[model samples]
Target: MGAPQHEDVDTVDVDLYDPGDGSIPVFRWRQAGQALATRRQLREMGLRPGGQSPVARIECRGGRRFAWLYRIDLAKPKLPMTLAKELALDKAMAARQTCPKCGRRYHHVLPLKTLGSCLECHDGTPADPASYVTSAPAHRLAA
Candidate 1:
């Protein structure tokens, strides 16, 4: 069987958004390069646009999908990860691992909606001291 022919939906005119007039030009897919870089591309190079606006954009899939492009010359180096930020992230994760009912930290994530507590706390059989006292012998209770 022969491959089906697809209609071209991405036919935006590059002249409409002229790059010469300092305006952001919108090029077709795989066409925005040489002078521009996407966000992921910049990240791969350990660079960022800093605060500069996009120099252009790549539009595709009938203009439904678009990726903003920034000038490589204008991009800045990415900042280093700090110890303070790492510690804060660790604290946030620790809080999520702690069970509310048992006041204990669990290795695995607990189901908040279904269990709502630790496995021991949510079980059908009671495991508390009060339950043991109630189920004591009748003669012991009378004494």
Candidate 2:
């Protein structure tokens, strides 16, 4: 086996970390393969070039939406996985709330500090976030 080869550095500014970097440099780059897709395409497939937001943005062109900008941080494995999990957890939080002691459930905006243990669990108990486990699966499915 030999060392892997990498393409020459492609220094396009990432969307989340960068605002617009002027269209000229981006336009002149001569897209090697098929050009990266528009945000619409990515949204349809649920893949963001930069990943998801709090770090991704919807960019517009000519008054119509163009593409998604992602943070380079999204490319980091740890952050991407964490974001995916958070998104899933947010969806779950939106879905329902639970009583940790009785396992009965309810619906409400869960307190951020009480993410793991529900209101019932922490009733007169210490709010030790470290001791709790999220109800979310260990690995969340990408939306």
Candidate 3:
């Protein structure tokens, strides 16, 4: 027998989306003057820098355009958005809360309303407890 002939194979266009008259492409790219930084975010996320990267097709309500981030795999485990969100919330609640100044992380044992700042920031100075708990600006923190 010749190499067992399998007649049928699937080939199709997988470009799941249209970038909306190139506006989305321009919006997606963030570069400085003379800086090769269009969509530079892909680099840290272990993706190619050039515009050849493939974005995933995720189901969403309201049809609002948004980006979904994930590591590439031949197949990824699927879950409904509600369950996925619950799992993420549980995991985040379980994380060790960190101190910005001292870089110490401790179990988030206190009640959410009661716990204001990390132990170090709480004891060290009268800075806004909210400040230590803040996230970085969108432009500064990529991927």
Candidate 4:
């Protein structure tokens, strides 16, 4: 008998960083395989995890940074934006872009949290006329 010969085992030159404690497998950087995708990647593909748990993880920089990997086939299509959602989002943005003192809604976000009002109202800086709407409709979203 020569040195004990192991037979009937499949071997491949791939690094599977499994913790061996029954946890999900880990892969390095771009080694997570084509079937798996991170959350952001799924979103970019117009998909969502759809309540499915991650089956693996991909790490980089010596495991200091990692992202969960989900099966792309198990992902669901991203939800479509509805009229209600658009209205609610617009309302929220109005609160941030509208000046509290003059009620003018600027196209850009205002520093309300810091200065408590627009620059013109806070420090007498003359804002550009093209920067804001003089009078927004009272019920823009009304039918």
Top candidate, metric lDDT = 4
lDDT of 3 by residue, 1-143 (tens): 67865521121322335543332322222221222222333444434433334333232232333343222432223335688899897657644454333443344443234545554455654545454434442333232
* Candidate with the greatest TM-score versus the true structure: 4
TM-score for model 1? 0.43
Residue 127, candidate 1: alpha-carbon lDDT: 43
Against the hidden reference, what TM-scores do the models get?
0.43, 0.23, 0.21, 0.47
Clashing pairs in 1: none
TM-score of 2: 0.23
TM-score of 4: 0.47
Identify the runs in model 3 with alpha carbons over 4 angstroms from their true place: 1-87, 94-96, 109-116, 124-143
lDDT of 2 by residue, 1-143 (tens): 77665521233343433335433223212131233444445445555555444333343342133333444434323336678999999768644554444343445544545456466455655534443344554444444
Ranked by lDDT from best down, the candidates are: 4, 1, 2, 3
Q: Candidate 1 residues 26-81, lDDT tens each?
A: 77877875778898899999899888998777777656667889898899988765
What are the lDDT scores of the predictions, listed in order?
0.66, 0.44, 0.39, 0.82
Instruction: Tell me which of candidates 1 and 2 scores higher on TM-score.
Output: 1
Which residue pairs in candidate 3 have backbone atoms (N, alpha carbon, C) closer than 3 angstroms, thus clashing? none
lDDT of 1 at 33: 57
